[model samples]
Target chain A: MKKYTYTEKKDTRSGFGAGLHEAGKKNENVVALCADLVGSLKMEAFIKDFPERFTQVGIAEANMIGIAAGMTIGGKIPYTGTFANFSTGRVYDQIRQSVAYSNKNVKICASHAGLTLGEDGATHQILEDIGLMKMLPGMVVINPCDYNQTKAATIAIADYEGPVYLRFGRPTVPVFTDPDQKFEIGKAWMVNEGKDVTIIATGHLVWEAIEAGEQLAEMGIDAEIINIHTIKPLDEEAILKSVQKTGCVVTAEEHNKYGGLGESVARLLATTQPTPQEFVAVNDSFGESGTPNQLMEKYGLTDKDIVKAVQRVLERK
Target chain B: MKHTTEELEEIASQIRRDIVRMVHGCQSGHPGGSLGCADFFTALYFEVMHHSTDFTMDGKGEDLFFLSNGHISPVWYSTLARAGYFEASELATFRKLDSRLQGHPTTHEHLPGVRIASGSLGQGMSVAIGAALAKKLNNDKAIVFSLHGDGELQEGQNWEAAMFAPFNKVDNLICTVDFNGQQIDGPTEKVLSLDNLQAKFEAFGWHVIVSNGNSMEEIVKTLQYAVSLTGKGKPILNLMSTQMGYGVDFMMGSHKWHGVAPNDEQLKLALDQLKETLGDY
Candidate 1:
């Protein structure tokens, strides 16, 4: 496996804030609405830089979504900020009818997604947002791996011209990807080149996949790592090409084992290639109040879990 | 088009006729609220709004209107067609598969004059506020208008939007609640009480106006007054009262006709009562 290192750790939400600030600078039409989570969502920079272009929606997520959708009527690109739970579950009908169905250019930026939301437990840690957003037609679902990619995604979706769900985490993780990396929607990044096993991961699990690749290398096993950032318009070509080369695959994500990136990959493989696959995901269960690291380990979503999944898929192969 | 009250009333009768015919043709739809809202729709489309006949999704340089009570799509479809957004003949295709005029209003079909999908009640208020905010941001000077059913206010989201608009000083929005006192289940008072609605809106810091929705002249006057109240650092609300099924005697004063299309005999009675001054589909 190729050696990877990072000098610092950063929360992905700050990346979103930085990206939003950059987007606002580049385009005056980039407007933002937040349901009173300015600090939590790391949107202070954007709000401070562009106060007139930002709105404090006072904890009304549904209203924020509708307002964003309506703002698109006059060529304004609106981005809504809220927790993953409130962003997707609390206002799903509004997002569906106002944003997705209307084909409005609205970016739904969700912070503190998945189990990494920690201490807040199941109510706040939304494991089903990926499913909810991906099922909607014309919605582009993105779950960036790190701070750099999350910021890039936040900036990229502004120019995409449709509804997009950008999911990020609260925990500060290693900033592995390049600072100036160009983020492309629906495109997978090949993190490492190998031929024995293909490990496809998204969000925080991408880092775990890298660790798993390094571990498998110690056992003289070569692992191919691919980071899938965009979940909706899944990078099927990249997945199929990598899976065909490896002849087996392990899919990982910080989401429910059902209706997530794993299922999306399984669907692609089942129909097109019928490759052996194993999922490194949380079994159908709610998360509990624990520290982020403890929860990731307790829920079996670590590098060891990915390594095990890769081994299991190899057995099936 | 600054039409006279008589000319607008003439158009209202035609719109009502179209409402009944559009519902009857499909043998399904809401006719009561559409009939009740006919005069107001006619007044807004023909006289009150500074909109365009040529259709575009971005109503940037012109006033925009949204239908929160989207089940009354017949009235809007007729108004949009008669106002030259599309052919009046297209009204016949209402509720048909692949038709732009869905059972409720939608922008999915790329329907002109509709910027958002409504029918899931209590959503349009916020959408209208957002559009109004957009107009203010663009410095377009054009206002955003929206209509809602009184019963629709029972939806909690409308209250959220109601609070948001005035708090944010979304002054370029004019939202009117059809105070018809009816929903699909029964009279709104029985279904769910909206006690002292005027006081509720006033408490939200909106400039409230009351109008007779059935009267073309009253609708025109009240809507004009509502427009004059804009840009005053507050959103305006018009609580316009109208009888359900206003023109047809049998359907009037009952919630049964709220979503029911007229049977043949009832359709005949309704057509006789509403004289079609403009050609029908």
Candidate 2:
């Protein structure tokens, strides 16, 4: 088995902002629209260079989706930015009708996703966004692990046609992925390999999986860590191959246990391999204002949780 | 290609006939607004708009029109057909299974003339504003046009777009409001009075124009004037006055036929009044 180490930490949203600015320089058709969150979404550079292309749709997410859909009709690729809660849940019908069902070529760039959107609490944190977005017919759901990957994925989806839901988060985490890595949409990134158990994680949970792998190694439990970036087009081939070798799995994400990455992996395992699986996610409850560390600990979403989940699933195997 | 007064009336009469036939074929569509906007749609397709005979989804390097009040799709379909965007024979398939023309105009069916699906109200303005911005981005010079019902302005998103377009320098878009003063429930005044519509648009930083939408001469003249107002850094709006259910004798002056297809006897009478100018599809 192979291992990797992290030396720096950065928020995924900053990566998205950097990627968006790069996309502006690369593609002429790429235009951005934010619902009055220019500074928050880190779209300042894109706004600065191409001031005419950037639109400020004030506090109106639904109208922003509608306008983004319209912008695609005239051969302009539009990226809509806002908080995940308001971006998906608040404007589901608008996205459903105008973007997804119509099959418009629009990029829905969302920030502040999942429980790691610390201090804003449950009202702003959106745990069901992945489920909601993935359920749409033509929607591509991407949850990048760290800053570099987030920036890379943001730039990648600009060229890929059709409707896309790009989900990133607040709070800086491990920035282990390479700065210039070519981010593919549905391909899983394998960090390490082992025979005892497979850890499938997404978003902020990828680093947790890596930490849990190191912990499991001390106890002589060899664990494989795979970062599942694109959730909707779940890399079924990679997942099945890993689960076949390991015979058990642990899935982790900064979202609810019911509908997050864990549930997606469990669904795949149930029909295909029938492997024993455990989930490291926020239990069925809303989060309150707290530091990211406190919330992860309070909700049992730490590396210890992943380590325990791996052991529990191994017991089933 | 200027149409004389008599020719304009004939074109309007033909559009009215197509509207009846389309709604009757569907057995479920709004006919009153379609009838009311027949003259305006006829003028745009047959006389006013500079359109391509070969229909493309992206109307680049040419004028583009969007129906913000998409419930009036029958009128648009009839006009598009008369203008040769599609075969008139396809009119019989309106709202039928696997029809390209859905209950509302949708691009999902690969309909050549439609760019976006729009049955949802309050969304068209923003879409029009976006298309206008796209025109600016492309440096295409061609204008973007949109039509909305006066009552549909109740949707808050319309205001968001209204506040946005003018400030964003979306001057190439000309928005026309069908101030027919009627809605599904009743007269717009009785349902919800949108008093001073022209002033309301002006307050939102638009250059206001007024016209009798049902009159071909006024419609053509006002739209031509609207064309000249492009590239001025402010959106142009036309407060178009019309009569709900304009041509039909019995359906006129009320909101009874807004969403209802006429019965057999009523359909016969309505068809008889609207003479078949280019032959019914």
Candidate 2 ranges with C-alpha deviation above 4 Å: A270-273
Model 1: lDDT equals: 0.92
Q: What is residue B192's positional error in candidate 2, in angstroms?
A: 2.9
Q: DockQ scores for all the models shown?
A: 0.87, 0.65
Candidate 1 to truth, TM: 0.99
**Predicted candidate 2 versus true structure: per-residue lDDT over B10-45, tens digit per residue:** 978988988887888767898989999998887777
Model 2 docking category: medium
Q: Give the per-residue Cα lDDT of candidate 2 at A85.
A: 95
Cα lDDT tens digits, model 2, A47-162, are 99999889898998878988898888779999999999999999887888778878989999999998788898889988888889988987899999999999999999998989
- Model 1 lDDT at residue B26: 97
* TM-score, second chain, candidate 2: 0.97
Fnat: each model in turn: 0.80, 0.61
State the displacement of the C-alpha of residue A312, model 2, in Å, after optimal TM-score superposition.
Answer: 2.7
Model 2, residue B44: C-alpha shift (Å): 1.5
Predicted complex 1: CAPRI docking category: high
Where does candidate 2 chain A have its weakest 10-residue lDDT segment? A1-10
